[model samples]
Target: MGVADQINWVDAACWNGTAFDGGWNTRLATNQDVLEPATGQALWRVGVASAADMTAAIERAHAAQVAWAATPPRERAAVMLKAAALFEQHFDELALMIARETGGIIPKGHHEVRESVVLCQLAAAMPMQSQGQVLPSTPGRLSIARRVPHGVVGVISPFNFPLILSLRSVAPALALGNAVVLKPDVRTPASGGFILARVFQEAGLPAGVLQVLPGNAEAGEALVTDPRVPMIAFTGSPGVGRRIGELAGRHLKKVSLELGGANNLIILEDADLDAAASAAAFGAWFHQGQVCMASNRVLVHASVVEGLKARLVGKATHLPVGDGASGQVALGPMIDAKQLARFDALVQETVQQGATLEAGGTFEGLCYKPTVLSGVKPGMRSFDDEPFGPLVNLVTFDTDEEAVSLANNSQGGLSSAVISRDVGRAMAIGEQLNAGMVHINDQTVNDDCTNPFGGPGLGGNGSSVGGPADIDEYTRWKWITVKASVPQFPF
Candidate 1:
């Protein structure tokens, strides 16, 4: 059997103004190679929905949403529960597949799967809490307001955290009675497909209720522009997100963007150097810092800067970097040559600009060394740009005020963290930070199913997409009034 047959990918898009035929492609449609990042070799052929396919998906999903909205909320949640069970049963297999596609370290892949399972359960419980309000009314009339589904949601997910990001949106949308036309990043189709499409299919969701169309930018553009898709949930880089938001705006569609970060990890003078160093090492190098919420910039108090630097460099140099498929690798190769090249260029540029390369700045194949730079300043490119790799730019500040200034200096504000022994003191400093999600003695990479996620300014458009608050983005409210007696109006 072909890879498409094995994966059961949706092939031709039905754009002849009719219904989709459920066809699978004989071979990969696009010329793009689906490569294993560590080896830079083709893993498997991929072919999913095209632009026309996405258009058909939108129409079909719109049709499906009407019935889904009529289904009891508890019944809808049941399907989500079943899907979550399927995801749990196949957790290890799914994690391995994700590692293959995105060069995610094995532990990181497992972490994503576990988090996805929690999110699925959270989505399952959403329907029970999706309640309408009975408002106060006059004696002659009854007034009420209820939340209703947006019909269909267009989900555009990123390469990193492929399963968690895509399913996190898909589950909540479905729970609230909306269908989803998910366009996952083309580079990691299997990661999205296995966990989302296949698991949900096995869980017996209604046909066309959830369609995973894995293709390039054209497919994404089609999803964004489709007339029937009323709401869009996207997670990616800021530049692409801005463009997507612009197009969605032109079409008058609701779009939520969870863009990446140039986040900060602040170590106050009161922080324990050992604990701070461990957090810094993991925050910067985990999955080679491909995480959207990774701590790229570290602001250390001048009083403890030397001690923190010594511990951090000591910890970073000990991390083993290689292919994740190999035994127990602490760091993994970047997703592709393009990302590795970008990482190399930026690290080199920062070093040339006079930042001390204290620990690492070397690579073998796609694996870049975990690097630490000591002397990054306010205007340095490394301080401003989100490298999105295994590199940390260290900047020292004299006082608490200076550290807060250094932390809030960036345009991006997706994630921020403050390390201090005093909880009262750290949270106060956290309040001063400009990012959306603040961490007290925690890594910037932290997340949970119950907490709000996303950022402000350059990070994103300030839309939070997690927990109960996410329902606001996927559903809208409508007011209904019934008059018990005929209205007496003078015109």
Candidate 2:
């Protein structure tokens, strides 16, 4: 079946919860084709939102915020729960569309959809969670502080993991009584923005409560600087995230950023070589290494570096790679040629700096082979820069201390992992690493609805989302006090 048959709303203009602007559906000058990365086929043509479009969406969201926030908490939770149900009902369809839209394998498509469902369900529960607490004050006064929603939240999500990342902010914000204006990546507008808006709309969300605007940097800057949008949630590269942080600071707006990472995975000498190899392979090649949490640098113990490398290379060479829409494959195509070129340049520079290419280093269409590099150490391009492709760098460390030092040597510390047969020892090493999230016996790429998802330094602004952190990210405390009568005061 064609993609249009699978997703009926692919041709609609952007979902702004307002009257369609003249630019939409007019095939105007700003319209761009959404291409299937693997085949370079145009799946749909969408109207790119301009700065004016962004302002309109945010204004609508801001106008709707008061009524949505006043809607009973149970009513809000009900709508979110229904949205979660709709996501579950359309899981397979959404997964197929994700694969076609983003060049992700079937498994990754399903994973993204499932995580988005989990996020919806998690957000549904927030309405019932304790929003605030009563505090002691004078005998005649009752003082309390309660969490209240920011009027409107502007969400800027990336192309990778589009559905879940966008929903992570949208779900919680709406459930907490805040309206949302989401600006998904221009590349995957349907899966990231339109599909989400469709789901929530079907679930009985009121108009203007959630708006999806697909646009470029101008729209993003408008969303950030809009005085009405009190908070901005962004997930993307470090450069753009830093720029957003700076702009938000100048406007005195609250911002939460989830940026890029050059994460590390360490294999101790005592680690089960087979298991460690499998973990490393999955971490580096899963989703074609197009994830912030992908294991970019592998720090293995000197005694077992060769052993682990052999197993990892064996896995890399055998894993299937192809167009995701064709069938199940271990690695899918890169998002596009630009991203592929970026990753390829990093690999070439690293090789020129003396690292040995062990397994694969070529491409077929957008599918780059799962590549493994050895003799990689600090200061090498492959070791320092994040390759958001199917590539892994192998480095050797003599001791656990050295392993920790090497792992901590990067400015980006989003996630880290350590593999060892000794659980306590691995845990100790994981603790020493500078990453926000650490795994003792697993790989660097990991996620869950209940865990806090963020890191310190370049990974983020030391702020977090998911689980309990969502409350802090989406709401602010408002102190309220009441008394039966005014106390007599001597002035």
Q: In candidate 1, what are the lDDT values of residues 81-101, reduced to their tens digit?
A: 898887788777667777878
Best by lDDT: 2
| Clash pairs (backbone) in predicted model 2 | none
**Residue 37 deviation, candidate 1, in Å?**
1.1
Q: Rate the local accuracy (lDDT) of all candidates.
A: 0.80, 0.86
**TM-score, candidate number 2:** 0.96
Can you tell me which runs of candidate 1 are displaced by over 4 Å?
A: 1-32
List runs of model 2 lying over 4 Å from the truth. Answer: 8-29
How much is 125 displaced in model 2, in angstroms? Answer: 0.8
Q: How many collisions per candidate?
A: 0, 0
Worst 10 residues of 1 by lDDT: 12-21
